[model samples]
Target: MSGFFKNAFLIAKKDLYSELRTRQVLGTMIIFSGLVILVFSFAFDPAQNTTKAVIPGVIWVIIVFSGILGLNRSFISEQRNDTMQALLISPMDPSSIYFGKLLANFTMILIVELVSVPFLFLLFDFHSIGSVGYFLLVLFLGSFGFISIGTFLAALAANSKSSEMLLPLLLFPVTSPILIGAVQATKIILSNIEKLPDAVAWMQLIGAYDVIFFVLCLILVEYVMEV
Candidate 1:
C-alpha cells in the first residue's frame, strides 16, 4: 500500500514539476476560462436584475468547458515527452499511473476553479463565498468524477489522430450527470435556498458518481495501459 502511494506521489510530483516549468496546461486553461467569461459578459446584460438567476448556469458551463480543456491535456504532457511509455515501463503498478494522472488532473482543475471562481463572482456579481468551503467540496467531488473518467478516456484517446476533438465527444455525454449534480448543488448553496435536502441529495449523487467512476477507472486503467 505504501509502495503504491509512494509511486503515485512520485509520478504526480513529476507531472507537477513538468507543468510548473512549462505552464502549458495552466496557461491554456486560464486563457480558455478568460474567453468564456468574456463571452458571457458580452452575451448577457450584467446591469440587469436577471443576472443572478443566470449566474449559476454560466459558472457551471464555464467550469465544464475549462475542465474539458484541463482533462484533455492531462495525459498530453506525458505523451508529448514520451514519459508515458517510461512510466509504463517502470516498476510502478498501472494503477499508480492512473492515480498519479488523476491526482495531477485534480490539482489542475482545482487551481483553475480557484482562480475562476473569484473571477466569476466579480464578473457575475454572485457572492457565495460564505459557502465557499461547500462550493469547493462540491467542485472537488464533481471534478473527481470528471477526472476519473477523463484519465481513462485520455489514455484511450492519447494515440488517436484527433484526440483533442475526440475526447470531449467521448467524455461530455458520459459525464452529464456530474454537471447536473454540480450545478444543482451550486444553485442550492449559492441561492441560499434553505433546501438542504435537495442539495444533500445531489451531493450524495456526486459522491456515488465519484466512487463508481474511480473504482471503474482503477480497474480499467491496467487494460488501457496495456493497449
Candidate 2:
C-alpha cells in the first residue's frame, strides 16, 4: 500500500514539475478566471440585492469553467509526449495514474480558486456572513468531486478527435449535482449567517457526492486506461 502511494506521489510530482516549467494550465486558468470576474463585476451592480443573489452562481461558474480548461489538458500533455503509453506499460497500478493526475488537477484548481475567489468576492462587494472555514470546506468538497471524475473522463476522452468539445459535454451534466450543492452552500454562507445549518446540509451532500464518485472513478479508471 505504501509503495502504491509512493508511485502515485512520484507521478503527481512529475506533473507538478512540468506545470511549473510551462505554466500553461495554471496560467490559463488564472487569466481566464480573472477576465470572467472582471467582466461580471462590470456587468452587475455590486450594491444591488439582485447581484448578491447571483454572485454565488457566477463565482462557481467561473471556477468550474477554468477547471474545465485545466482538466481538458490533463491527459493531453501525456498523450502528446507519448508518455501515456509508457506509463500504461509501467509496472505500477494503473489506478495510480488516475490518482496522480487527480492530485495534480485538484491542486491546480484549488490554487486558482484561492487566488480568484477572494478577488471575485471583493469585486462584487460580497462577504461571507458564515464561517470562512466552512466556505473553504465547501470549495474543497466541490473541487474534489469535480476533479476526481474529471481526471478519469479526461483519460477516457483524451484520445478522441473532439476531446476539447467532448470533455465539457460529458462533464457538465455528470457533475451537476455537486455543482448545485456547492452553489447553494456558497449562497447560504455568503448571504445569511443564520442558514449555517442549511449550508452544512448542502456540504454533507457534496461530501457524499465526492466520496461515492471519487471511489467509483478510481475503480473505473484502471479499465479506462486499458482501453
Best-fitting candidate, scored by lDDT: 2
List ranges where model 2 is wrong by over 4 Å.
none
Residue-level lDDT tens digits of model 1 in 53-91: 677687777667777787788777667668788888889
- Candidate lDDT (C-alpha), each: 0.81, 0.88
lDDT of 1 at 22: 85
**Candidate 1 accuracy as TM-score:** 0.93
Q: Report the Cα lDDT for residue 68, model 2.
A: 93
Q: What range of 10 consecutive residues in model 2 has the weakest lDDT sum? A: 126-135
The number of clashing residue pairs in each candidate reads 0, 0
Across 102-209, the per-residue lDDT of candidate 2 in tens digits comes to 999999999999899888889988765577888888889988998898888899899898999999988989999999999999888878869899999999999998
Question: Whole-model lDDT, candidate 2?
Answer: 0.88
Candidate 2 residue pairs that clash:
none
Worst 10 residues of 1 by lDDT: 124-133
